[model samples]
Target chain A: MMTTKNGSWKIRYILLLIALPVLALLFSLCVGRYVVSVPDVFRSILSRFNENIEVSKLAYITIWNVRLPRILLAFVVGSALSCAGLLFQSIFRNPLATPDTLGVAGGSSFGAVLSILLGFSLIPLQLVSFGFGCLAVFLTILAAKGKNQSMSTIILSGIIMGSLFSALVSLVKFTADQEQQLPSITYWLMGSLQSATYSSLLIGLIPIAVSIIILFLLRWRLNLLMLSEEESCSSGVNMPRLRMVAILCATVATASSISMCGQVGWVGLIVPHMCRMVFGNDHRHLIPACVSFGGTFLIIVDTLARSISAAELPISILTAIIGAPFFIFLMRRKGGWNL
Target chain B: MKLEIKNASFAYKNGRTLYENVNFSVESGEMISILGPNGAGKTTLLRATMGLLNWKSGGSLLDGDNIADMPASKLWSKIAYVPQAHNRGGSYTVLQSVLLGMTNQIGLFSTPKEKDIRFAEETLDRLHILHLKDRLCNEISGGELQMTMIARSLVSHAGILILDEPESNLDFKNQMIVLDTLTKLSSEGIGVLFNTHYPEHALRRSTKAILIDNGKVQFGATPSIITEKNIESAFGVKAYIGQFETEHNMIANVIPVGLTKDEEKTEANEEDSDVLATLSIICSKFEESERINAILHEFNDILFGRMGMPHRKRNLYLISVNLDGSKERIKMLAHQLSVLPDVSCKVTYAKEEES
Candidate 1:
């Protein structure tokens, strides 16, 4: 009886499977002036996969090299931010909490921008940016760790650390030579994957991949964290240790994304809540949903940023414009302010 | 298994001592209620038992093993806790929230199996609230929310259930439901330690009671041991203990003097000389003995000289006095009145109700 009842409920999973491709295709096609037909895109992908008749080199390059990289980067970055956000929200057990809200992104932005203007091109500027990102997060964690491990204390530390790095970033921006360094630093701060090289993608890839893998593995622990500390403790979780590990994983993922992409906002803060609103807050459903949705959502957003103007707009500006209104809508729909 | 606390003391970081030097024990299958006032640390004691707090001093044990030394995961299998429902204001569905109870068993990639789902469903069914299985947690009524939390605790299947104010947010109907469930869980050999402000709930749900006040264990015993003195000590107020027969069992109501409005106002009115003058004048119309008996009847069972009244046994007597200075004196007065031969006395005295 149990088996039949449980087995009969396979339609939801099947629907998710069915919807995934349709969403992916729609996301892929929505970007760029050269509107490639779905069939043509599919044929191109299929021929490339099957090693069939030689396809147009321009179509392959445009689809595979230009559009696909940008789309995949958006997806990967979005997934990283949202996953990190979900992890932070559950760990802190607060909806207002997110991975970037802790100033990890701001710190990384300072590091990346500093490396950019200072002309420290050695060791791949991405490494320098990621290093500074890790440093800022480490300092914030240290500040928050002094007292009893309370959620409020950690949030306060994040705010303090975020402000400090932000001040430093402003300082660096103020003194920079206007001709050479200003535009580059501004572009970096505004945040675009336009400069997304296969090399740069590889640099961002390690941390995002590692962080997502860790989050997926600790999904059960993340769910447990939503319970009261007492309940979590009694449930056999080495809660403090698990919490530290989760927070570290989230920090690394967020910091790495920030270093590579340069301050992509709201995806970390808003996407998880959106994911939870649609899929229930079970981490099993929540984690995967956030990853896929975040990736798709960001891909669409970046596509819009690139295609809407004669010149490509910075992705961060577009994200804030779209994301802020959507976030407010989510907040209203959730009716969280009433509480 | 036995849960033991050997001189446990708890204080917040601000040096606000909640409970200090408290010692108590609970055997397997026993249901105990820890009763206290708002700031008296009933919740803190529960937190200590669950090893959720860094105790200022002293120790807690689960079946002779020191809880502080035990890892949280290992300790969890032995004890499951349901905190007050109000704290869980997250945007989680009832089923999803309850399924979180299987955190120890389920892995990240792994889906919930038929057994886990069945266990969760059964727990909800046992609480008779299976209809709310798919509802968002925030959308549910507070009573149903409390029931869902209980169901979540049940799914953990721990040897012990520690509930901190499980009845606080619940209405009377849900409170009764929880008491019934706790009683059943206890009967099934799960030791239950619940903190409650309601004396009646303690009497209904618990085989034993631990009265906490002033950051200490004031009294720990069976419901029978929860006398007027104990109530007064735990919450500095005199209570009117009324034992009444019910369809299923005997019901004991410990209505404190200042807590019940109708009772407290009448006590205040009795002291008025103007009312006394009017009563004196009316009494003069009847014979002295008949007037005395009539005057006694006019006053609700809270006053003196009640010999026979419907629902009141012929052995009834009433003791009314103003409580001065402290609860200890009022308790002494009530004790003296109760000991009077062939009389079931009611003591009514003015005292502040400790919220």
Candidate 2:
């Protein structure tokens, strides 16, 4: 009954959501330390599918082994955090909500720190980190439960849990050996995609992908969650169930991401805000927008993280440096946003 | 569908009882207005009725099923509730916001389909808000947002609608649009129950009125429920309930005079008896004459004789009827006729007997 008022504009934006991430992925592949030319990267990728093309080993090794896994890792972590951030914002009905709102990152980082201090293997470290992340959110809910289930109370509990985990991480750091274990623990806490091997990626990608896909499937009902409490309940949708599902998914996504790549903070808050500014709050538009833009943003940031110096800089610093100014500019231009 | 509250009682969590032994039923084609003073549990009553808040003892029944035990999707598909116009989902456009009412019918994984969108647009168009379909709800005016909310509720095509002060804070024109829309919807066989701050709106539009006053809930025909004594008792204000003559009808208007500090109450008149009267009517339009005839037909049992004539050149109609009914019925019939447009009516009562 209603025609799309700006049909071309809508299509152009959709194209951008898809195209930006692909471009970022390509950029990440072509701009690393031992760089391959754009055509060589394309040709090397094509050679695997087509036998007629000649393959270059340097291009193949650089693209497939080192940069490709890292790039995919950026996309996975970025998309997962962004979707989780958006879901948390909707569930709390507050724009300030993010992936770490429940302290999953802090708890999981503590898990990694404990693993590193105890001299665990890479696989056990990731598993321990993921387990602690889930535990953090469970503790947050337990703390906030039966207090009328108001959102602010849960958020306050999340903050308390987050601080508690951070304190534990600090306690571990104070007692850790300063020679070897301390540096690795500190490096992991700063967040980097340098250790993104295929096996690690495979272990982390399961929870992130499953949660993101489930969040995407339930995108339409998310708008209902943004409504006031009584309004949402009377909408005939099972709001508490929806809220629990969203919180659980976001928890899994955030925990898996933190376990894999330390604490990638700004992407969760910034990317979802950018997507909301561009696409408004219809989760139908916001979910896909958050995934694509979130992935692309981290891909771009991670590319810059590795290339800006002889030594890789911490990801959190660059993300804040790059994301804060951009977010402030967008917020100022739009005046502000509402839930 | 009929929504019935039977022996429903409600109390706050602090053990303060809001209301007790409340009973009312609204069916298709009926408009029921809920009136009460501030903090008199008007909102609580509505929330409890919709099962948003639990009733302290008794529960609401939709048709036959217990509402408290019903699943949300099953319950909402039959009843639509429009809350205060200021809602939290302002980031959505008008069309999308209205389409939210279709969430129950929509599948868990799917977006709104073409048919659902069409229905949403049609409901907006029916409310004359199709022009603002793509506009964000926050970018629109308060009245426009209220209308959008109403459009959302209507899009569900529910058998019953409940609104919380749908016309409050709206401009005069928006008020008319909202009140008129409710009237038209009820005429088309949708039960409408709304909370209102205006007793006059209840008198003008609703067939049934409920007043929650002094911890008591009263329900009856609109005219009887909104009398002067009831208004004073409910709102703690001495107000005059008088009729104003408009071109089409006599409209009941409530004018509050001053606040009452004393606990004294006015007693309702006990005078009740049959009366003999002759009613005279005049109309300039044929439609007016027909409306008069329809009103007069309701009191057909009291009529002993009737005569009518049409003056062709002057295009006027004159009718006279001799009536024998209770004093209230005759006054009510005359009051009803005097309210219609292009008609003038008067009733003259017969003298008392010497016995």
Candidate 3:
């Protein structure tokens, strides 16, 4: 009976996590200034298949060109950040670890601000930010080497590298044009999905999807990374190779997401933790749970950010506001941060 | 399957040799216990044997193939390792934890199959912890946690299991339970190699004992290897090895007294003239007379005068002896006399010039 109960609970949680996102995607597609009905949204989508089905041209452009790409971008970016977060937590064996722990966000923000100050085009800006984010992680690893490669050493080096990158970002902001460049750079740092176009979605989706698939496929071995270095090695895990692959995938996903959407925080850190609390810490279940819940959670937050006031708010502001209180609730409910 | 460590040597990066030329082999259905004091390289030896650390000289062979040449997954599938009890900390259920041992059996990207789950269940049942299968590992007692770890290793279906101090943190009953489980596993044809601080445990459960002292290793059958002389030299303590009959069979126990410091000091003063010592022996039961006689006969070189009186009503034997010998020799004779069951010996020494 207990065995069956456990098996059924896992299946049910997985189904709920997956279904909730699809439902949220559909629901969010309806809630906006225009307030399209759910059936209208479905009819608009169905009109693509049956040309005879009558749908307004305005609805078609709003749904297909505007809302769909933005929502899809939000979902991909959210799930990518969450997957990177899970990878970081497992490989570092520290629950507090996130995609930003290795200075990816800080380095990418600096690169974005520098590009804005130099009057670079949008594509070059994204490429520059992605390159700098990866470079920051590489430098962090280089600093952490030759000290037995302990987790604490790597974490300490990451903190130092993160601070250095943040300082560089501050320097870039200080030197920018006060009227034109500074405000734009500050707004970009706040993070938003408002600029989510079909091209931006296409650019970020492939790497994020590829990385998430890799993480999902290797979910079982991710459990081994939770063990100590010696224990994992003795258990037949190639610790260095596994860790390198995981970090590389996580970095690619995080950098691509940040380069597209600027610096969206808290989703990466909090989504994985919330998933762990609900579905236990087994990565096989935890990874999918994070992907689903994270995608749905960000889409809802972005919807609220857009609708909460007349002017749109940045996605990061809403995520931190919601994420901080929920994290506190989780900590209080669990009695302490055991992780 | 057989595991052989042939002339294996290990040293730290700073050039201090932890152990050298350590040679031993264990086969299926055999248990080898490594005994040593704290910081005696016991853990290092185990790590070296498991290939967690590379050896500087020589290597291990599994079934005549070099272990180093084998892939880690292949070698680990044949030889499972369990770290110390304290190192296991997590929220995985007993079932999930044990299923982790199937790391090698399952594909890198694949979850456990139905047959892997069945194997894991059978392993838990074999360890008699099937009832704990659903319980979280951290919520279980330490002894139960230990059992789960062993079950985890067993689920891999490894032919050999190497544990580091499996009984260190447990209470007496739990210690016995863990040891007994290991013994049972060995009987089922799985080789068990563990390091422990308790020589009595090694004597009871281990088929072979390896005593590492001061960079040297002594390996042999448990009974022959765990002798008083070896124990004294290894641990600097005087020990007595004796056998007692239980309802089932005879069991050997090693009783270690404090270090032989007094004997060493007296031996330093051996140039002094021999002393005349008088030893009074009392036996509460008549059955102990033969053992007391044998003990005295073994020390006959120091015997000068001996007298025995049997009190038939009390069924006790009282013997008194005067001996001329060095203080060390006299003390050894008295010590032997005191070790016999139901017998006690007291000695009085008086300095005398040689005549």
Candidate 4:
């Protein structure tokens, strides 16, 4: 039964969602190549503040430098992508809408590959990718402008732009040297948090955090966006202005997340639906629920990606492997897309 | 508050004029019904008056101020719109859905406060749907959903409530519930305007009626404007106008008989003849006088001479009318008179002479 008496139960559910990610973060910090015990992990983390605590120097370096940034980056990137997906779905009024529906991911992928082909360093590569991701959406918007620029026209233009940029990505891949560059490009497209560093984390965090805050403040209005354009307008919402702001915020979040982690697919699309199953479709609860559940889900997936075998698998492969079955299970249990 | 549309004309982008020189005014506490056939620009006129559509000429004035110049927030604060009932499927609960109507009242970043929630609750209680506050909108029946929408609009405290066919696709009880709610709202000094296909609903509830047909509009009091002739001309259907005596007062009913195809030919041929008949209509009781009056007024085109006398002691009204038209017209008038329950009529035709 879907109860609408929102009281202590809602707060309890939200607290549980928040606790899951924190627990996942703790577990992920212990599951790397240099396995550190839970107590030792805490000591290593605590030793950063307290010099009196005796912890292994290797454990300190491993936990702080390698696993901590990777875990935090995965959580941030996941939360950013899922919230973007939620916003996009609300604005487009389509349950199937994702961050990449507006060509952001495709454009960023093209940019990342082009920068790699140009032999740019990691920081510049991510910057170029983020810039092109925004540019792709900008161009899509430009293409959709006309005498009567309907929502369908904008979505259609996004599809066209996505395909165009994807073709460009393939062209870049084709012209590159097959031995070193091609494999690197392919691995990069598959997505991983293996290169997570403090500088790279900082680079992605600023935009993601800003966009997230903006979306959080605008979350209540997102409920109105679920209504028809006429109803929203009649209800005193400036539909065009709100939609543009939402799109800009979602695009920024998505582009920044993709720049950090090459293309973590399905986290954006699936986490919100999963959250909706737990928390009802009201955006007030649904946005925060998506954030917590998404971060937890990706952290666990990243942990499994690094710990599953002797050679680490890409995060995308593990996400698809885990996410597809879970999605099918949700479909079977829920019977249909109630949202 | 008065919403006045002065000589408004609207043309579509395709150069098709939907309506021209449409003029009407609705004041606070007045219920106006826009009655017409499909494609008659009833919805178009409503949208144009609300400034949803750009009109070629003229404008809508609210309390002598142009509505176009007012900001949307201020405009929406004063005017609430309840669209058709079919737009009801959503995941929000009834209270949450109704709270959305306070969008203008609440700031952009703030959520609905306790006062706003109390207002929504009071509105739901007023509409007798308070028990449905926690139910998801999609889980409720269509009638309940319609009530929820009305409650939504009511919470906004809008002075003018415009509904687009609030009773469409509803069962008899649900339709009555919706119509009664609308009437109650209008009686509470909220100017109500609704467009509907049922002329009987217009006759029963509306203080004023606007009949739009073939790009032209006829606006006047409901009883004077919505007649058998207007219904037939507007919808290409023959209508019978009659009245029923309720416990409190007499209410008129417009019943559609069927479509008429050769009306133009019949009208043209009937104009050439002059057949005179005298109709003596007797209402058996005094309470049936209103029904008799409505029937006389409905067929007044052919009725030339009319006189009425009430037998006070016996509680009866005897009405005598002399009608001049073709033989078919006189017969049609007599046929209409014979249908009332307590009314009887005797028609005496003059013998034909060489002219």
Candidate 5:
């Protein structure tokens, strides 16, 4: 009886995951200002297989240049952030850990804000932000070391570094021109996928996809990290190499996702917990669940953000609106938010 | 299954050493109990054997192969380690906790196969706790927790079982249960080493004993060869030694009492006096007693070399004689004096040589 129920649940999860991207693609094409019918969207996507069939130039342009890139970027960034969150949570053995828990978001925001005030291009600003975010996470880890750095120490150090960086961002905001410079900085902080283009989307996909693949391959090793260091070592794990690879892979995922979506809050924190709640805590099933649910969750949130008003609401604001109450519920129920 | 530890030493980062120059070995199908006072590095020794601590001086060799060189998975397969079970947050079922013992057997990418489940079921059955397997660990009695730990160790298919204080913090019934399980395991040819504080516990089950004190191996011998003097030196205590009636067992019972300050000072003062002179004073002191004739008879026994008195004990009491110019004669004098109703006999040893 248990086996039968487990088998059906596995199939249900797989089917739901496969259907998500298709639904997201259809929603992205059909809900925009130039709304296309679902039948038209399907035909336009399939016409590439039959090149002899004539397709409208406008439909081709929307599918190729406008809508396709946004949907793909949302999936890539959602998967990256959720995977990063799962990695950090497992390493610290805390369900509350997210990409921002290590000051990655605040440091990246500080870099981007500094660049805008200094009149840098969007490309150079993103590069600087990504570089600074990785640097901040490493420095936080260093500050937390003792005889052996404990997980709680690392987490508290991350909080300190995050606050320090946030203070610097506030200082940057204080000196900027209110009408011209301030609004752009504020908009960037709010986070949006409306600025996504084919070029930026392709660039973000490389690091995100690579890191996700690394996460999947190292899923087995991640379970060992949940144990104490002595247990992990005696259980045959080469502790140093496992730690280095996991941190580097998780960092790549964090930096790329942050660069694409300017601090998309709470998806990373919430998705892993939701996955663990539905599935068990074992990373094999949990990691795949995070990927599917994370993307679907963000796609639906993004749809609400864009379709609710004439002007698209920032995705970050919407995540807080949903994530705050859910976060409280998770804390009360699972007792997993101690970090 | 010959486990040999030679010249093993360990120290913490703070420069306080837990153990140094330690050496011992145990053979297959043998039970060796590590007996020590509190803070005598018993747990440290167990951790070193389990490869949980970083050691400095030497290594533990299992059948001539260093434990450090063995692959972790194969090493665990040979040695089943049951860490001291403390309180954890969850109320995971007993069967689930035992299932976690099969963690290494289950591949990372795979679920538990039928064989793993069968092994767990069979272990619970062997422990006679199959009905309680579905109960939460928190809901069971302490006796059940101990049985579950033993069952967990058995499910690992480990040939050598290492437990730290398995009998500690357990009620008498649970302690006996754990000891019985260990005996059954050893009878099945599994090498077992466990740390214990109770000598009787070790004396009851283990054929061999290793005593540790001040981070040194005081004695490593079979139970038959373990004498009162050895235990006294190892634990710095006074002991009474005798034989058991039924089993020809040489029992060494240790008593942990030290001399009071005044008693210690008086013992130090008696060292300067000549033995002959002190015995002469004791004989004169008890010369006029009604028990004098009885004292003379015991003294004659000492004079004939049939019995002897230990030196320091003769000085403190008033009923010894100086006939042989030694305290052995004085002990005979005191034994005779002990028969008088008013005269009490007390024996003492010099502080340095007592243990």
Candidate 6:
């Protein structure tokens, strides 16, 4: 049952959602391992435009170079993964779909493992990882559409293709040297944002940003993708084209984010579901909600990952530790999920 | 608007051909019903006619253009389809769900405009579901959700409406609500085509009916196609279409009593010889009178004398038509007139075809 909601509560709700990511970004910048005071952080950020306001060189370097790019990358990867998750779930009409639903994570991890074994540098490894991620989706589509086209067959093929890539990754891991390559492979597979340079951000930004923007532009039609096949087709949309474009975009976003940062896992599965719990299932609200809350959730998690201990913790560990319980609590209170 | 399927045939891969060379035309202001047993390809015909599925050899045409050749957006903007309610967990609010109907009208990067939303609201209001605008679609009853889906289709401003089992999961009253809405929409000059499992519903409401039994398809005027013998053969049951005389008019119904245990062909359609009769009609509204005129025009060759008198004070039109034709076509014309809203027609024979 729904109460007769006035427009005032809706306005307040939208404002609160929009504010979360902005506030999280600010809070993340000020309270890190090298703690810049809040006012000093704002002053230093503003000092670049006005040089008359004196700022210490160390604080300047730490705020602008170290924390800014890292947290910014955190926002990018976070939103990208969650948007991908939301898109896949709508496309498959299944609540359990994730950014890795089409095997992008498995395929990209195998590519990264192979790259490390072959002693390839960072850029080539990222490219190889993205290329394989796309290849996995392509193969899944081909297999699913081989004889007769159906949604259930596609889901089955994705599961098969995903496990195949995971097995291949394990084979590569079994072949890597224990002392040098294995530990690095294992660590990277656990996921990290420590290598979030400005260049890495630039590379990862294109696919994620472009796809997210395109998806936002075609936001309402995303609702149609969740409809049954006949219902969707009759809505006067070019459903095949819409479906192709959406799936391609979600794939690129998920693949590029995995290539940029290793495998920050729980944010993709949890953030979109959290948004649905709060905002309901209208894509007009769900898309923007996923973008904002996803970015905010990851910024907070990554901030804690870097600051909680002397050595950096894997971002995925923090995400599960924080996200799982919160997700469970929200589910219980909200009384379960629907799409 | 006219949607025509010409020589279209369909079959699943490595399976029996469902039907061959099926052809029918549905024009604007006409209500057509499709009745078939399970697995008779009732739904598949609708899908292929809309080009959602490809036919084996032939295809459908909208006006003069082939449906398969037109762009999806162009074709769908002119033909709205409401599939059967699936009791899905989709939680989009009723307003938002209906607003998605304007997807093809809005641009690639645009949300629906204020004008589009107003149209959606007006459509829901027309369907009497305006109060449920902010309610979630899944949270409503099956009938409400069915109406919501129909409203979504109507908001597209399509000239032709197709529905697949729009009344299947509903109670008697809910079925009447849906069927009456469709009938009213059809009278408003939008071509309405729907698949129904209830033969009585088809015979009672449709201007034309298509029956697909096993792999054979038959299409004709509603009364002629949904005869008692046809129902018996199609459904494998001993059934009869009985006329129940009410105070206002003669309403026809189908009663299925028992299943057939033996395969015996019943040649019971031999009583359609020439006869002379007069059909008296009372139309409560101008629209119903106009519909009556259209139906009478089709039998003008057999009709001889016609008279119309309008009582302005009472808001009713009293008319009588003399027809000299086969018993089948005359009864069909009377049945067509009787099915319309606020229209009652009775046939009185001058020369009866004796038993």
DockQ of each: 0.26, 0.59, 0.31, 0.33, 0.08, 0.55
What's the lDDT of the predicted structure labeled candidate 4?
A: 0.85
Ranking of predictions according to DockQ: 2, 6, 4, 3, 1, 5
Q: How good is the docking of model 2, by CAPRI class?
A: medium
lDDT of 5 by residue, A39-88 (tens): 77877888878887667888877877777777777877787888888888
- Between prediction 4 and prediction 6, the one with superior TM-score is 6
At residue B94, what lDDT does model 6 achieve?
89
Question: Per-residue alpha-carbon lDDT of model 4 for A95-167, expressed as tens digits?
Answer: 7898998899999999999999999989999999999999999999999998889888989999999999999
Q: Give candidate 5's TM-score.
A: 0.73
Q: Against the true structure, whose TM-score is highest?
A: 6
Compose the digit string of candidate 5's lDDT tens values, residues B1-355: 7888888888887888877887887776678788877788888888887777767879888888888888877777777777666532134457665665666777754555677777888999988898877776656887788787778777778778888888988888889888888877775678889998777676656756778866777444344324454555556654554433222122334344552343322222134321432222233233334345444564563342222232354432234433443453454344334322234433333333333
List fnat per candidate, in order: 0.55, 0.63, 0.48, 0.40, 0.07, 0.67
**How many backbone clashes does every candidate have?**
4, 4, 0, 0, 1, 0
Instruction: Write candidate 1's Cα lDDT for B1-355 as tens digits.
Output: 8889888788788997777787888777778888887787778778877677777787888888999898766787778888777755365667767777777677545656778888888888887888888787778888888888878777777888888888786777877777777776776788889988888777545656788756558545444446665666567777867656543223557788844333432232122211110111111122233423543443333332223222234322222332232333333333322221122334333434554
i-RMS for every candidate (Å) is 4.7, 2.6, 2.6, 2.3, 5.0, 3.1
Local error of candidate 3 at residue A10 (angstroms): 5.5
Report the CAPRI category for model 6: medium
lDDT against the true structure, each candidate = 0.71, 0.86, 0.83, 0.85, 0.71, 0.87
Q: Ignoring the other chain, what TM-score does chain B have in each prediction?
A: 0.70, 0.85, 0.73, 0.75, 0.68, 0.94
Over 4 Å off, model 5: A1-6, A20-29, A32-37, A47-64, A114-120, A143-146, A167-179, A334-339, B68-77, B87-158, B169-177, B197-200, B219-355
Off by over 4 Å in 1: A1-57, A334-339, B10-21, B54-57, B107-109, B213-216, B247-249, B258-355
Q: Per-residue CA lDDT of candidate 3, range A212-270, in tens?
A: 89988988788888776666676776778889899989999999999988999899999
Model 6 regions more than 4 Å off:
A1-14, B87-89, B267-278, B297-307, B321-326, B348-355
CA error at residue A4 for candidate 4, angstroms: 5.9
Candidate 1 lDDT, A1-339, residue by residue in tens: 112224444567446734763477456754577777666676667777788756677666778778776776787788888899888888888777877767787788888778877887623667877777788878888888865768888888889998999999988899898998888899888888876667778778888898788777777567777776665665665778888888888888888787777778788877888877766667766777777878877887888888898798998888889989998898887766321
